[model samples]
Target chain A: MSGASTSTAVIDPYAPFSQGKTIQLSSASPFLPRYLASTLPPHTSPSHVYNTRLRGKLLILDNPLRESRSAQLKQERAAKREAEKQRRVQGVMGRREAKRLGVWELRKEDAKWALFLPIHHLWLGYIAELLQLPPPPSDDILHSTDPSKHRLPSVPGTQAKLVKADLHGSILSVKRAKNADLVGRGGIVVHETENTFKVVTAKDELKVLPKRNSVFTLRVPVYAVRPGTGEEDGGPMWEFELYGNQVCFRSSERASRKFKFKETIEL
Target chain B: MFIDLNVPFPEPIVYESQFTPSKKKQKQKPAGLTNAHASTSAMAVVPAHPLERLRVPDRKALRERVEMLIHLGYTIIAFTQSVQSKLDPAAPVNWFDGGEGTVFRDLDPRFNGGKRGVVQLRRLNVVLDEASEKGFGFNAQTTQLLAGYDILSLTPLTTSTFQSACLQHSLPSSSTIHLITAPLLPSPRLPYYMKHTLVRTALKNGARFEICYAGVFGDGARNWWANAREVVRAAAGGRRDGHEGVIFSGGAGRVEHLRAPGDVMNLGTTLGLPHETCHAAISRIPKSLIIRAETRRTYRAILSEPKLVFSAVPAGAAEDGGEQREDGKGVKGLMEILNEEEERSRKRVLEADDAGEGQEGDGEESEPSGRKRRKRRRKNR
Candidate 1:
């Protein structure tokens, strides 16, 4: 007993005084576990100490009570969460912007190529390029939107493949005359006849005034000037590569004998 | 957790008084012509812009124009043999901008029977094949063949009360559609939905597709493959057998799988000509096949090159095969000659009548009358 007392004194110098105080105090005196020291209030008085001690014991001693409290809190939180979810569901339920499905709704890609109107000309062409539509008429000579007259891009001897090369910055000149033979020379032949024929020349287009019914000739194909004017007066010109350097001729009856120079200037 | 029912709650409604009919005297009934005139006035307001108004061009006039356009080296409607329109007789069907318009009811002689309030519509369908002894005869040499050729269909929901009972009937697929705006050059500007719709119609109505297929590499090889399995797989037996041949043989196997380059090349060669000529024909394309050999090239080839596959008659010949011999005298039998002469005389008289009416009515206005002489024939039958 003496040895134990000496060890207790070495471990805790206040153990003997603490034991004596517990025996001397009534039921109101504080008695808390070591774990509750950090959680409890710092008041160290004898009065109300038992209430603090009871609270500490209640928190530590019973597992069922703690479980019931936690479960009740979880239930309340779950109810609140479900209410919010229901409100969100009603918010988006009646929406006008939502897509209305049909028996056959067109896909975005399919809708792009539906028609050829002025508004969709450029965009439609891009879509056509993406879809890769086939060229019309598989045999014989090829035609444009107009299907009657078959077009030979170049003379038969010169089997050159023509394509659209350049449009802007290309110089085009227009000429009106009584005779078809005039304003055409070299490989160029008078393909057609009308009151006017606009000679679409290369970058080196020249300006020449006809000398009193004297026939002047050019070395390029001349086309009748269409009404629509662009940056270049020739309208949209396609590049033609000759299969061979063959000269071709076209015959046309003169419509207007009298020729007055209009806008036959450089453009 | 709560699952929301999202049921809509009803609000309160207030009672309202009933509307009482007025006890005013009835107005006098208008004359038939006045009523017609009033309806015409209303219809005129419907399409204010002249260009936006649907013009029912005379079939003959349109055909002539198409022919002229074709001759001029422009690509017009190539697949169609003819086009006509069914519309309300009361509505002013103006095919042109000004007067002397080719109205549908006024032109077609049979339509004169009972057309009143029906708004006739212009519809265009094409004849892709003709019936032959060997079965349906298609343009074999033409590489760019238009598949899924079907009667253009339309459904009219409403019309004025003045239309005749026959006119109020459901829209007919025979002549309710038309090529209002034809394709430009090299290619036709048709929407993908339109193409899809056309394909669906064809598939549902015993039509086959002439697919422009290309094959690409699967194992990252340099060779390209053809993806014509859709065409072959969707076809009947795919062989040149009898009617039972329509059942595709490759359906049992995985047809969508990427085809070998050699097989595609062989199929292209087997299909008469290379795909380069026609929009739908198979053509060999040298493309990098490493990533996706089957998807590099554009697969939609709808347009076709025009060819002289059939004609009403040889350009210079009559009903008889007279052009075979180089002799100046006609080779036709006596009866054939007599018939030809009679036909020529009849044609001349008709031509004279046409010339006389040229000022009052353009040649296009008379085309609807021509349909009375011919009858529509079903191809499958």
Candidate 2:
């Protein structure tokens, strides 16, 4: 072994084994000379070498100040984050004001606008209401939740058997089975035929026909129904909805609940 | 000027049989500071970062992208589970193939091998819990493992823990959550504890949530969307009055519609749906959609379809705070179903007895004949 290699053998990789404890100590300077001894070898007197190093001498770096690479990176990130925060706050304000001035176009803003545009729309609408901006001429269809009430003539029908019930809707008005009564009623409806029906009550059934003479409730289209399990009795159970004239349907996957519902309604 | 009308149209190139595998595309880091919290190991291995921001889908591009993922270390099963769980946890977490195997032989196919192997599950669970405890916005909840699911919890880990794990040759924090469950929406019919645990780990660590919904138009047209933007937009638009600033779904922004964040015990009353129906809806919607209910705001919705409107009572119409439904609708427990079945059988027996009584013509004589016939049939068997 080289003369230097011979000395390195004395040092321990896992060091500071005291009593029953094993503490890992840095071995970086195990062979490196103390600052006092550059032309000479490091003697057993570490204290003597330390004192000698205090005096002007040919130096050996026993423990150099190592760079904290991660610390520097953290500082840089903090600076960047501060800058970003300022930018986002400014953007929010700018967008809000511009919306107020009625000159804001979604296309002109940066991609961040896409993130904030929906929020901005809501805020601006609120602000406009507070400022008493002349209400943009409102239409019944635009605001009314009961557009069906204005058109549909009440149908004379009884609620069908309740298939399923939730906190929101009940699955009722099921056809194709034997005669059944409205098991119970909070909301009830009757289907006279496949195409003629009324929402006398809010049963979670399909409103087969037009609510009014001309206006029709939306039902999901037939083609949208996913091919069912093909049970011998009935191929599959399908659900439909009519958004005006459009219909939507979904296939059932009872096991995994991966039902595929398709919307036939155009936005 | 005469136009040449008979010019032969160029034949479309038919490249179906000749599959030209494209060059591996570069993996993309999610939007924002992907490095802020990601472990170096995750960054190194999973080049395409999944957690930082929204991933809008390119349907045409999915096949190739998935193929590339297969080329990477991920198993097809992992990929499918990741995608489906992201869409809806209730959806059975399925895969294209059982696992990923190299096209060539002589390769170690398992995730871990002899020497310098990855960390084990027990250690992983410890690390994740420690990290979550140390970090802000990180919380861990331990509960009974749902049947057919893994037993673990999803919790956010600290950045420092992430760094150390990478340096220590342990599994990435992204896969730390062992048993996860998606938030509820649509329907809460299906629950997979093991798949959910994986999803929770991925999400808590940093996986972006995406919903892949196949839809069609009113004209019988079909299309699929890989993101939740369109659904959110439409659902939000349909909200009556003004929205309560937030919407909740199953998980985090993964399904149709949105809901408020936080506990939504009274979502039905807030949304103007019957309480039972609302509860049912919340339970059913998979962990795909993020859900929250307004603290003080209530929105009234007009129920147009009668069948769509559910009654609060289990049996007939009952007042608020009444007994369960009479028809046994929405009864969900082992005991309840067993009781229902017992009741049904007893009803059948009673009906048979009634039929026997109605046949009064020599009923006493008929009973003896029936016994004789049964004995004869048994003997023949």
lDDT of 2 by residue, B1-381 (tens): 000001111111111111222111112223243333333333233222221111224222333333332333221111111221011112221111112211111121222221221111110112233423343221222111111111122312333433332222122221222222222222222121223333333333322222211121122112222112232222222334312211222221122221222123253244343343333333322111110000001011011122221222221113111123323343222212223334465679999989878877668888889899988965873
Docking class of 2: incorrect
List ranges where model 1 is wrong by over 4 Å.
Answer: A1-267, B1-206, B210-229, B236-381
Which CAPRI tier for candidate 1?
incorrect
Candidate 2 structure quality by residue, lDDT tens digits, A66-86: 769999899999998888789
- The ten-residue window of minimal lDDT in model 2 chain B covers B291-300
Evaluate every candidate with DockQ and list the scores: 0.00, 0.02
TM-score of 1: 0.15
lDDT (Cα, tens digit) per residue for candidate 1, span B1-381? 000001011111111110122111012222442344333443343333222332233334433432332233221111122212232122212222221111233322123332221111121222211111121112222111112221122211112210111121112121222111111111222111223333333333322232222122233112212223322332322333311111110000122432333343455444333322221211101000000111111111000111221222211112112222213432222122222334565679999887878765666655655554432322221
Model 1, A195-246: lDDT tens digits are 2222222221222223233222211111222223211122112222111101
Q: Give the proportion of true interface contacts each model preserves, from 0 to 1.
A: 0.00, 0.02
Who wins the DockQ comparison?
A: 2
